[model samples]
Structure formats: C-alpha cells, structure tokens
Target: MRWISKPLPNNDVVNSLSKSLGIDRVLAQLLALRGINTFDEAKSFFRPNLAELHNPFLMKGMEQAVQRIFTAIENNENIMVYGDYDVDGTTAVALMSTYLLTLYPNVVTYIPDRYAEGYGISYQGIDFADDNEITLIIALDCGIKAIDKVAYAKEKNIDFIICDHHRPGDTVPDAVAVLDPKQVDCHYPYDELSGCGVGFKLIQAIAETLEHPFETLIPYLDLLAVSIAADIVPMDGENRILAYHGLKLINSNPRPGIKAILEQVQKTELTITDVVFIIAPRINAAGRMKQGIHAVELLTEQNISLAKKFASEIDQYNADRKELDKKITDEALQQIRENNEEQNSTSVVFCETWHKGVIGIVASRLIENYYRPTLVFTKSGDKLAASARSVKGFDVYNALEACAEHIEQFGGHKYAAGLTLLPENYHAFKNAFEKVVKETLTEEQKTPEISIDAEVDLSYLTPKFYRILSQFAPFGPANMKPVFKATALRDNGYGKRIGKVEHEDDLPEHLRLNIIYGADDKTYNAIGFGMGHQLDEIQQAETFEAAFTLEENNWNGFTSLQLMLKDVKC
Candidate 1:
C-alpha cells in the first residue's frame, strides 16, 4: 500500500489559529487543512449551528415545488411519495410522507421492488399511481434523468416534483420542478447534498411559506442524519450542521424504529461510523432483501411493539444479505483468477445465478482484493444489470459514459455507479470498459494509497489532545478523521493474530498489538482488522512505521485510548 502524507498547511495561518484558539498546533493545522482558518470558522466547525443552514428559497426550483405542494393540499388531491429502494431514498420517503401526513390526509408512499422495477422512476410505479388515482407524486432520491418516465407520468395527468442529487442529463424531464443543485442553472451555494438533504430542503421551503418556526422541524433531522450517513455525502457546510444535531437526536431520543434497532446493539454513545455500520445496514437490508416499503413502515411506525417486530424481521433480512454478499464475493474472486483477469486494469465478472440484491456489495468486495475499478453483473430479467465501484481518483461514471454505446442506461457518482445492458452486449461492454480504464488510469491511481494527515510522536498524545480531536465527529468525504503516522514503533512480543476462524481450514483475520514508540517505555494498545498476515513482519522488524487513527476502546466497564491501525510498514 502507498502511504502519502498530506501537504502541510501554511505555517503562518496555522500558528495564528493556534494562538487565537488557544489550541495545540497539530489541532490548528488539522483545522487549517479543512478550510477552518479563522477563529469564527473553527467555532462553526466544532459547534455546528442549525441557524447557519442556507435558505431553502435560494434554490432555483424551490418556489415552484412549494407552490405545487400547496396546490395539492388545497385541492385535496391524493399524493404519492415515491423514492428509490435504498437507505437514502427510504429515509427521505419516511421524512417527507410523515411530515405531509400531518398537514394533509391524502398522502401515501411507494418504494418500487428491486426485482420487478429497476432503479429510479419506473413505468410500473407510474401505472400504480394512475390506478390508485394519485394526482401528485413527490419523487425523492431519483428522477433527475427520468425524462421518458416523467413524460409517461405527465400523459396520465400526474404532476411530479423531483428532489434528487444526481447529475442531470442533456435535457431534464418536463416535471413541475426539478430540485437538484447539480443543474447548471441552479446557484444553490452548496451542491454536495445527499438525496434526503434535497427532500429536507423542499420541506424547509414549505414550512417557511407557512411561517412555521424552524424549531418545529428539528424532530425530522434524525431521518436526515441517517440518510446523510448512509448515502456517504460529504460532511461539511450544511450537511455537517444537519448531521450534528441529528446525531444528538438519535442518541438522546431516537424514533421507535431506530430505538428498536439500537436496543439490539451494546453501544452507549454512537458516532457517525456506528450509524453507518449498525443502523444504516439494518434499514438498507429491508430494501435489499425483501421490500423497501418495509423500511419506510418501520421508520414511520409509532407503536414501539410493532417497530420492534419490524426490526426483528429486517434483522433476519440483513443476516441473509450478509451470507449472500460473502458467497457472491468469493465466487467473483475465484472467477477473476480462473479467467486470468487478475492483471487487468478493471474487474468485470458476471454470473447468472448471483443474487441481484448483493451485486453492489460484491463489487465493493472485489475491490478489496483486486484494488482497481470493479464491476459485478447479475441477471436482471432478460437484461443484465451491474454495479460499478472505482478506486480513488477514478471516475467510473465517466468511464461508463465512454462506453455508452453498449449501455442501455447508467447513472451514479464518481466512485460508484450502476448500469444495464442487453445480454448480447455484455462482452463488448466489458472489453470497452477495460480499455477505457487502461487508457485513462495513471500509474499512482492503480494502487490504493493511505493519506496521513501528519507525523506525531506518541508522547504528544495526551488526553486533552484526544478530547480536541474527538470534536471532529460525523466525519466523511472532504472532512475525514485525521490519520496520524508514527515511526520507530515496535510491537511488544505479545502481539498476536486474533479473531476466530469459522472453520479449521480458515485463518484468523485480525491483529492485536501493544505498540511502543522509540524506547518511550509507554505501550499503546492497537488493533488492525485483516492485518494478521503482517504479524510476523512486525515481530521481526526492530522498528516500523505505522499509520493509524486514535479512538476510544471500551472493555469490561473500562475505557482507554487505542490506535485503530490502518497500515504498518517495516
């Protein structure tokens, strides 16, 4: 693995901020790297305020969307809240549909099936709305590129208000209003909102028109936080403020569904990482394994008993999802080796029997071993559907766009995407994608790299320093948790390969260590998952360099600082 140190911030700015804030220079430098150079900026970063959120009306389509909703309510029209069958989409549906139910009684939610109806807006979904006499459809987390689908809905006299974050096509759909900030005509100050964030903006606008106090909307932020965390949106600007307050709500008083899931885990205090791993997966499992409407049901349910029952069923779905994810991942890896494609610039593997629900997870797993742009395809009806994941610095969306001739439809962000093609075109598309990646990929982009924020001595790590560092909560893209590098580190002889093997034939996958730095005589506990193979290398080396993030470990009612090891080089 390549270890890259981030460029040091300007010394003058760093020193000035350190003196102004009365903070350690390392903390100031970290803040400066995150664009928090001024004391006021630092205050906002550490204590995000909801008052700092942008005005919802500033969005280009806000007025139209608000007017459309007002018209629906005034006319007593039956409205359908439509969303993609994913965590972000389902949470947005829950937030919007629940809020609307308070103002009007003719609102319902729809989550299309992953098997019968594909991603984004679908004709089948529109037909369902038509049959049900739903006149208005508020689509969240999708519809940016649903020109044909939107046209189809318009013919049925169903108005659409799209709240999405994905990039738009050459021509947008003829909807009542499209609320994506990615539009070139849109001048909304922040553009990196998650799909649920866009949905929140629409509600914020309606509340403003009704002169409702902003505090009344605070209860809905819990859903926003889940969406922001699960969708992997950047944690800065408006998103940071929303997530900060939302996390507070989640820990202090979560909704019944969230509370039910939390009761199953043993964490007293949860972080953004905990939400991503614990709550988001259970919520997503409903969509992935069975039906997304189940997730929405749980999120909106008021009865604690029913919520718990729903949570239990979703947990079973998650267990099934995990098994399928692992099985498909192993098969994909074997296929890579057997097909002699291990050396290729991209991984493109397919199996007709692979589960459609877990192909995206398998695509990510394939990257762990092959460490390149990867795609996993499974049969979806008569066509073929695939999930694509790319390494850092590579835009898989653009790469797929280059091979668009072979694609029937595709849309996604820089790092992840989805595509569909005719079964006969799979081989041509795979070869074209491999060629596009080979010609575009740079030498450094081929290998995964660890970015270290700074080099610090172990002696400098005090409780006060850790306290300041912990304020960098809710970390994500552009504002990640700081990774520190320490050199001349030696592990005590007690270091061992940890974690139990499922079977006698399997090997342990984790490493545990008591690490010492440069004869300091102070040992710090460290654990590295999937680093068992490096135990012998670290034991043989006199000293090694390690890249890690500081975290608090709790065990048997005792809490202590520990290093979450990312990589170690001897």
Candidate 2:
C-alpha cells in the first residue's frame, strides 16, 4: 500500500481561518482541506443546518412528481411505493410508503423478490401493483433504466413517479416524472444523494406543498441517513446535513424498528460507521436471505414487540448471510489458487450453486486478498448474474460498459455494479473485463493508496485539538476521516503482535504499540489491525513515520485518545 499525503491547503487561507475562528491551525487546515475557505463555510461544515438543504422543487421533475402524488392522494387512488431489495431501496420504500400512508390510506409497498425478479422495477412487481388496483407507482432507488418495465406499468394505467440516484441511460423511462439527479437535464445543485435521500426530497416537497413546518419531516431523517451510509454516497452537502440530524435521532430516539436493532448492540452513541456496520447489514440481510419486504416491515412496524421480533428474525438472516459469505469467499480464494490466476489483473470466479445473495459480499471479500477489480458470478436461472467491486480510483461501471456486448444488463455506480450475461459469454466477458481494467489502471491505481490529510507532530494531538476534529463527524467518501502522518515515531519497547492465537502457525492479526514521538513523557496508545507482519520492522527501526487517524478509545469506563494506525514506513 502507498501513503499519499494530500496537497496542503493555501497558507493564506489556513492562517486567516485559524485567526478568525480562534482554532488550532491543524483544525483550520483540516477545514481548509475540505474546501471551507471562509467563516460561513466553516460554520456550515461544523454545524449542518437543515434549512440549507436545496429546495426539492429545484429538481427537474419535482413539481410533476409532487403533483402526481397529490392527485393520487386527492382521488384516494391506491399508490404502490416500489423500490429495489437493498438497504437503500427498502428504507426508501419504508419512508415513502409510511409517509404517504399518513396522508392517504390506500398506499402499499412493493420490494421485488431477489431471486425471481432479479433487480430494479420488475414485471412481477408491476403485475402485483395491477392486481392490487394501484393506479400510481412511486419507484425509488431504481427505475432510471426501467424503460420497458415502466411502459408495462403504463399499459395497466399505472403512472410512475421515479425517485432514483443511479446514472440514467441514453433515454430515460416514459414515466410521469423521472427524478434522478444524474440526468444531464436536471440541474439540482447537489446530485450525490442516496436513493433514500431522493425519496426524502420528494416528501420534503410534499410537506412544503401542504405548508407543513420542516420539523414535521425531521423524524424521517434516520432512514435517509441509513440509506446514505449503506449506499456509500458522498458524506458532504445534503448528505452531511441529513446524516448529522439523523444520527442525533438514532442516538436519542430512534424508531421502534431501529431501536430494536440497536438494542442488540452496546453502543451509547451511534456514528455513521456504526450505522453502516450495525444497522445496514441487518436491514439488508432480510433482502439477501429472504424477502426485501421484511426489512420494510421491520422499519414500518410501530409495535415495539413486533419490531423486536422482526429484528431478531432479521438478525438470524444476517447471521446466515455472514456464514454463507465466509464459506463462499473461502471457496473463491481456493478457486483462484487452483486455477493459478493469482497474478491476473482481475479476479472473476463463478459457481453454479453459489447463493446469489452473497456474491456481492464475496466479491468485496476477494478484493481484500487480491487487491484488484473483482467479479463474483452465480447462476441466476438460465443466465449468469454477477456483483462487481472495484479498487480505489477505478470505475467498475465504466469498465462494465466497455464490455456491454457481453452483458445482458448492468447498472450501478463507479465503485460497485451488478451485471448479467449468458453462461457461454462468461469467459469471454471476463477476459474482456480483465483487458479493460489492465489497460485503464495506472500503476498507482492498481495499488491501494492511503491518502493522508496532513502531517502533524505528537504535540499537536491535544485534547482540545481532538475535540475540534470530532466535529467532522459522519465521515464517508468525499469527506473521509482525517488521516495524519507523524514522523520519527518509535515504539516504546512494549509493542507486540496481538489478537487471537487461532492456531500454532496462524499469524497474529493486529499490532499493539505505545508510540513515543519525543521526550515528552507521554506514550500514545496505538493499534494497527492487520499490520502484525510489520512487528519486526517496527522493532528493528529506531524511528519510523506512521499514518493514522485519531480516535477515542474507551475501556472499563475510562476514555482516552488512541491512534488507529493505517501504515508505517521507515
């Protein structure tokens, strides 16, 4: 792995902001790195205000979508709130359906079966809507590429108001309104919304239409924040505001569904990372293991007892998902070794009986060992389906587009995507994808690089400095957790390899250290996960440079700062 220090901010801007805010220069420099040049921008960054969110009506199809929904409400028409099977889709369905049911009684949610319907707007889902006498369908997190399915719904007199964030095709669906910000014609100021974020915008517009105060919609932000985190969208702009307040709700008074899920964990305050790890997988496990609607049911349940029951059931599904993915990942790694394809630019493996639900997770797991673009395929009916994951700085979607001739259908964004193809075309498509990635990936892009925000000395990591840095919460893609590099660091002789000793020959999984920077009488506690192999290097070197993020560690009711080391260089 390569350690790349980010470009330093302009000295003028950093000094000016530091003086104006009366903050540490390091904190000001961190804000400057995130493009906060002035006091106002810094305030907005630190304290995200919901009022600053863009007007929903600014979206290209917002007016039409709101009007269509209002028409459905006025006529008491049955409205089907439809979405994909993942966390973003289910949370979007739960948010939209529950909100619509507040205004009208004839609303229902539809999450297509993962195995039968595959993904996105499906014919089976449309048929279900038609059978239920639903006249209007509000599709969320999907439908940008559903030209045919939308037309099929139209034939049944069902109007579509799509709220999606995926990239649109050459031609969008003929829905009443397509509210994807990715459309070139749509000029929404911030376009990096999660699917649930788009769903929130729709309801924001609806709430405004009814002249309701903005606080009426605050309760729904928890769902939006979950979607934003689970879908891995940028944690800046609209997402930051939504996640900030949503996290507050999660920690203070979450909905029964979320509360029940939280009951299983021991956290007092949940961060965005906690939401991703604790809540998302449970909600997603319902879809991956059973039916997507189970997640929606859990999210929408009002009864605490029933919600706990649902949470328990979903927890089992998550457990099953974990076991299956680990087994399949082991099988996939073995396949790579058996085929002697370890040196390939890409890792593409397939099995006829591999569970379709776990392929995506397996693909990601493969990347941890191989460190390359990966695709894990499984037989989906007559065709083969795959989940694709890419390394840092690589666009899997564009790479799939280059191999479109072999793909029957594909969708998703830069880092992750899903695709299907005929079984016969798998090898050919795999070769083509390998070629595309090999040709496009620069040498630096192939290796995972840790981007360090700034270089700092041990003295700069004071309690006050950390307090200011903690304000940069809810970190994700665009606004990541800050990583700082400290040079001339020596381990205080107590450093050692740590973690479980599984077997006689098994390698230790982590590194523990009391990092000493200077003769300041303070030895900083540090832990480097998966860096056990570096124990010898650290012990031999008199001093080295370390890249790490500062975090608070709590043990036995005592809390102190800890360095989460990323890498070390001598």
Candidate 3:
C-alpha cells in the first residue's frame, strides 16, 4: 500500500496553539493540517458546541422549503415524506416524519423498494400519494436529479420540496424548492451534509419560523447522528456539532431502537465508529434483507418491547445478510479468477440469479483483491441493478454519468453509487464504463493508499497523550482517527507458539499471534489480529517497521494501550 503523508502546517502557529490549548505539539500540528490553527478554532474543534451550527436559513432554498411545509400544515393537506432505501434515506424519513407528526397528523412516509423501484423518488410513490389525495411530498436524501419525476408529480397537482445532498444535474429540477448544497447558487458555508442532515435543517428552519428554540429539535438528532454515521458523511463544520450532541444523547439516553440494539453489545459510550459498526449494519440489513420500512419502524418505535422485537428481527436479518454476503463475495472472486478479470483495467461481474441484496457488499469485498473500479450486478425484476464502488481519486458517479446513455437511473457520491439499466443494455454499459475508467484513471489511482498523519517517537506515547487524543471523539470521514508510522521496530525474543487457546478450539494456527514492540528502550506486549501468518517472517527478520494506531484494550479488569498493527514491512 502506498503511504501518503499530509503536508504539515506552519510549525510556529501550531506551537502557539499547542501551548494555549495545553495539548501536544504533534496533536496541534495535526489539527493545523486540518485548517484549525487559532485558539477559537481549537476550542470549536475539541468542544463542538451546538452554538457553532450554521443557521438553517443559510442553506439555499431552506426558507422556501420550510414555508411550503408550514403552508401544507396550515392547509391540512395530506403530505408524504419520501426517501431512499438505505440507512440515510430511512433515518431521514423517520426524523422528518416523526417531527412532522408532532405538528400535524396528515404526514405519512414512503420508502421505495430497492429491488422493484430502485433508488430515489419513484413514480409509484407519487401515484400512491395522488391516489391518497396527498398534495405535497417532501423528499429527503434523494430527488435532486428527479427532473422529469418532479415534472410528472407537478402535472398531477402535487408539489415537491427536495432536501437532498446528491450532486444536481446541469438543470435543476422544477420542484418548489431545491435544497442541495451542490447547487452553484447555494451559499451554505458547509456543503457536506448527509441526506438526513438536510432533513434536519428543514425542521430547524420550521422551528425558527415558529419562534421556537433550536433545542426543540435535540431529541431528533439521534436519528441524524445514525444517518450521518451510516451514510459515511464527513464529520466537520455543522456536521461535527450535530454528531457531537447526537452522540451525547446516544450515550445518556438513546431512543428505544438504539437502546434495544445496544443491549446485546458491550460499549459503555457509543462513538461514531461504534455507530458505524454496530448500529449501521443492523439498519442497513432491513434494506438488504427485507424492506427499508423495517428500519424506520425500529428507529421510530416508542415502546421498549416493540423496539426490542424489531431489533431482534433486524439482528436475524443481519445474520442472514452476512451469510449471503460471504457466499456472493466468494462467487464473485471465483469469477474474477476464472475469467482473469482481475488484470483488466476495470472489474465488472454479473450473476443472473445472485441475491440482489448483497451485491454492494460483494463489490466492496472484491476491492481487497482486485483493487479497481468495481461493479457487482444481479438481475432485479425485468432490469439489472448494480452497485459501483471506486478507488480513491476516481469519481464513480462521473464515470457512470459518462455512460448515462445506457443507464436508466443512477445517483450517489464520488466513491460509491447505485445504478439500474435495461437487461439488454448491461453489456454495453459495462464496456462503456470500463472504457471510461481506462481512459481517465492514472496508475497511482488504482492502488490503495494509506494516509499517515505523522511519524512520532514512541516516547511520545503515553496515557496522558491518549487522554488528549480522546477529546477528538465521534470521528468519521473528515476528522478520522490519526494513524502513526514507526520505523526501526525490533521484536522481542519472546514469542508464543501457534496453537488453539483455551476457549477457541476452532481457530486455525494462522489466527494466533503474540509479539512485542521495542520503543524507548523498552519492550511492550502487543496482540495482533489475523497476524499469526506473519510470525515466521518476523522471527526470521533482524528488524522491521510497522504502521499502526494506538487503541485502549481492556482484559481481565485491566485497561491499557496497545498498538493495533495495520501493516508491517521487513
């Protein structure tokens, strides 16, 4: 893997801030690398007070969207909350619908089926709303590019207010208000909100118009936090403030759905990483294994018993999802080997009858081996649906747009996207997509790169240092946990034999490891996961270097720091 070091900022400025903040020079340097250099900026970075959140009216078209919603509520018009089928979509629906239900009773929610209706706003949803005498639809997480779909709904006397975060087309949709920050005309200072965040801003605006304090929306931030984490949005600016407060609620008093799910886990305080690994997969399982509506039910359920029931069902769905994901991933890998597709400029694999629900996970898995722009497709009803995942520096959405002639519909961010096409056009689209990637991509873009925050001496590693780092909680895309690289590492003479431990008889020899790292003239014990295979190599080598992150591990009523080795070189 390529190791890319971010350029450090001015050392004098960082040192001054470090002295003022009472933090390490290295930590201050990293903060300055992220453009936080002043005392005020450092305060905002570490504290993340809700007062730092941008005004809801700062977002383009937010006033119009809120005004339209208030008008619908005053008129007693039937309103539908529409969203996508992923965690972001479902969470947005739950947050907006529940908040609206508090103010008006005519609100309902609609999530299109991933298998049948594909992604984004659906004609079936609009038709259903029309039949039910719904006059207004507030779309969350999607509808930025539904130009014709918006026009069609308008023709049916249905007004739409889009609160989305996706990139808009050249011509904006003719909806009542388009609230995408990507719009050229939009002046929202922060542009990296998740779909649910956009929905939250809408509610914030509505609350402001009614002369209500923003704290009135604090309870709803739990859903926003889940969506922000699940959708992998950048945690910075307003997003950082929202996620910081939201996680406080999650730890102090989570909603019934989150509480029920956390009962089976062992974390005392939930961070964004915990939300991504523990909560996101469960919420996503609903869309992958059953329907997106189940996720909304779990998120919005008020009763403990009902929420537990939904959580249990979602746990089962997640199990089923895991098994299917493994099977399809193995099959996709076999196809790559059999056809020698791994050597191609791009990777596109199709299975006629493969489970449509797990292709996205399979596509992500293929990246570990093939490391290319990959697409995994399966037959969905009369069409072919696929999930596209791209390597760094490659915009999968733009590539898909290049091949839009053969695509029926597609939308997503730079790294990940989803698309559908007529079954007859699959071959043509695949070829065209590969051609685009081959023509535009560079050799460096194809290989995986691990970004290292900085190199530091092991002497700098201490519990106090960790305590300072811990303040950078709720880490996600933008404010990722710092990774450090160390060189001239020597393993101690002590090494454990590879064998089954007391409780794990089924584990293979390659799954065990017991090693030590020499730092500051002392040896520290370290346990490595899935690193036993490297035991012989490390033993044979005289010296080595490694990249890792410091993690606090608890065992037998004791807590201490350990190096979580990511990679090693001899």
Each prediction's whole-model lDDT (CA): 0.93, 0.93, 0.86
Model 1 has how many clashing residue pairs? 0
lDDT of 3 by residue, 319-382 (tens): 9999999999988889988987767878899998888888888999888778889999998778
Pairs clashing within candidate 3: none
TM-score of each: 0.97, 0.97, 0.93
What is candidate 3's TM-score against the reference?
A: 0.93
Question: Among all windows of ten consecutive residues in candidate 3, which has the lowest summed lDDT?
Answer: 507-516
The regions of model 3 sitting more than 4 angstroms off are: 398-413, 421-440, 494-521, 527-529
Candidate 2 lDDT by residue in tens digits, 423-496: 99998998999999889988987888999998998888888888989999989988999999999898888998
Model 2: C-alpha RMSD to truth? 1.4
Model 2 misplacement above 4 A: none
Q: What TM-score does prediction 2 earn?
A: 0.97
The per-candidate count of clashes, in order, stands at: 0, 0, 0
